[model samples]
Target: MKLTSLGIRQKAFAYSMTTLGSSLINSLFSFYYVKLFLNRYRISEGMFHQAQIVFMLWNAFNDPLFGYLQDNAKVPCCAKRHLSILYGAPFYAIAFLLPWFPWRDYQEGDWLCGVQLVIALCAYDGMLTFVLLAQCALFAEISTKHENRLQLIKYNQVASLVGSSSVLFCGLISDNMENIFNFQVFALCVAMLAFGCMYYTGMNCVSQYEHVEKLEKDKMEDASNLSWTSVFYLTKQIVTQKNFLLFIVMNFFQVFHLAFLNNFMLIFADHLIPPYLLPAFVKSIMYGAGFICPQLLILSSQSLLRKLGYYKIILSVFYAELLSATVMLVLGPSHHYVLSMFLVANMVMVSATFSLFNLPLADIIDADLLNYKRSFPLSSMVFGTNALFTKPAQSLAPMLVVTILNQFDYEKLKDNFTHSEQSALQDLHGAMFYLVCLTPICIAVLQILAWTPYSIRDSHTDVAKYIES
Candidate 1:
């Protein structure tokens, strides 16, 4: 548990690899997938939705399966949890390009295209699930002290910021609609970068793995002995807790907010921000600023988090996000369609919320460990099991956004102009309003309601008191 400065930096950089790739892949899917595949490649809207649905189904089994595997992995080696990332990282990098490439031309409404889409989603997301589940579980397992965990999480966030900002660099490539191929090449490079970072982390970060291996050896309970049915039963037992269930609900809505912005921000910019003010590179710059500013705010507000506790701070974040979304919807169109500034504010709020949103979950896990007498595997179970709910929100958001846009004749707007674009543009405007404002406002309200009754902060305090006594 004694982490030197060098170890801390090394571990942070290692984990950053995961976030770098994760952010790149996630940004590509969230920001560019619909634009590239559906808009440029002529992939049908129906096909895009189908691929997401299929991926959701794949995640239903894949997340928990890996969660169980990591929790109960009986590897008499360095770290049972690290095994997934060690093996899965390469596939994670390679599979990301599958959906971007096809043997034949992608035709709208083509069943073959739909089938290819499903296969690609499965391949890419399956490897993603394997690596990410382990990385997430490590957040708890890597450090036991609260302050140390916070430091590590801070490092993790720095990596996340850098990874998310990678999308901005893509603007350096051709942003022209005709340069979709160039965009795909950039995506390929990002994938390789993701793999390289992960590979180094997996190879060099052996200390934590060794520590976890020792803990597993000394543990009394062995989940590996249980049947598959017990997996469901155990997951049900954990999720059925009032505090854990509420956390899951709050996290879901929070992710929905993130997914909305990530998935729709580009399209929203296209409709809301005038081309004269926020060109493609400028939009990327704004997006990067949006992500970075909140991190800086959160870092400066560490004092606020200490004094106010996570509950109040989180409530403030929700309200701040709601207000920002409302302001954007009302005044976004008024400023000559140059609303990139407001987008930065919106990003800051979202980034702040997301950056610290999971602090409670980590505390909740600590409380569970104190009460239930478990160890690192418990972290795996909590984070891994929650993905069943959280992943749905993440997957569903893009589909929902695209579906809404499609209703507004979004596909027609993407195609070569043969008729008046005025009607479609107006519909796009309406869709952007709802996505940026109404949908988030509603989600924020739900998160507030769910978060209000949460007393995990009290639970964490109670555990701290017991330790002191």
Candidate 2:
């Protein structure tokens, strides 16, 4: 299909609206949920652990289930990617609002608080997986050209710059999460705004190329005849692929690193930095920079990405992170200014690299289709299976971090910040410094090991050869 300049711009805008919506809601949840539950609500460690366990199971299960349903469904809303988003976006928005309001008046150590955490996480994740699987599937279906994908990324990142500011906006309006009423009000507004963006995208975005239509028709015919054994076999083929294994292994660590940062950056900032050294506004800017600078970096690095390719760029990012984290660890948190600068820069690089993940993922999907000689792309299935392995990290990161921090009397520190003993504060700061520095160092190392043998670089060439044949 030939797209005019106007058509391209319109497509880009429509596609970007999904990112705007997803990023806003996901950022709000990721940045604040752990803090809200553990710190604000005073959820017991045991209860918190129980919630993560339940969330992990649900998170792992939903991805492939949603993906399979979307790919195989007969309904127009499910079969057509954009329509799925249009219809599911409202439910997704409502799920986003779940955690902001307490279901009951609960005292400290209340199991009800943990129940709320579980419900909020599972509900939000289920809807998010459904909506985003469609969006991701649409991404692969919408364009096959490398340049076109980059163009989409450029536009999406621009949208993300705006969407990611939800955290900053929340920080301002909620008085950095001290004001509960204001935060709930912000959540309501965000839910409405996010719904609007997803609804617009679903209504406008198009993924109806002739080949895609043919593939869907073929897939529908195949689905009618599919059985339990064949379904299991197809899944085996997908999960056992070498590229998929490598990507998911690497991706798990990346997800963990991102979760670690998103969920705990505010906590880290508050503990590690002296109040006199960094004012609230400046810290807010730094927090906001974590979201904004990454997009700007990705935008500027489009040329570099093309030149180096995904593998090299990603490997280099890991090395940079490893080096930066190591230096920060050596310098210690006492060098407040230097530590703060490195922290923000490292967060930006991680976020920027993570943003490019979908490009390589698309390549993997293309490779899979070529390898299997399938008529239609199992784009959502591939994305979902990948998530099946990696989404657990989202739960695990917070659980493990909180577990570690608890050893340093973290709960006590939070409860009595103003009246905490100096000795206890010193120990907590030491733990925080090590946690921030060492976690990234370990993740970067593991990512490097996992990603080194990834072979999807040749997928584009394979596509060209397939086309020629």
Report lDDT per candidate: 0.70, 0.86
Tens-digit lDDT string for candidate 2 (372-414): 8987778889999999999999989999999999998998888
How many pairs in model 2 have backbone atoms within 3 A of each other, for residues 3 or more apart or on separate chains, i.e. clashes?
Answer: 0
For each candidate in turn, the TM-score is: 0.89, 0.96
Error of 2 at 85 (Å): 0.3
Model 1 lDDT, residue 209, Cα: 40
- Candidate 1 lDDT over 1-469, as tens digits, reads 4666776667767766677667767656556655666665677877778888988888666777777777776653213546667778889888887777665776676677777768877888788888877777666656555555566667767777777766666755646334767877887888888888777666655435455545656542565566778778778778888888888898888777777777667767766666777667766677667666766777777666656667888888888778776876787566744366666677677767877755776776666776667544366677777877887877788888787777877777756423447776776776676667787679888888888888866422332312310
Q: For model 2, what is the C-alpha lDDT against the true structure?
A: 0.86
Best by lDDT: 2
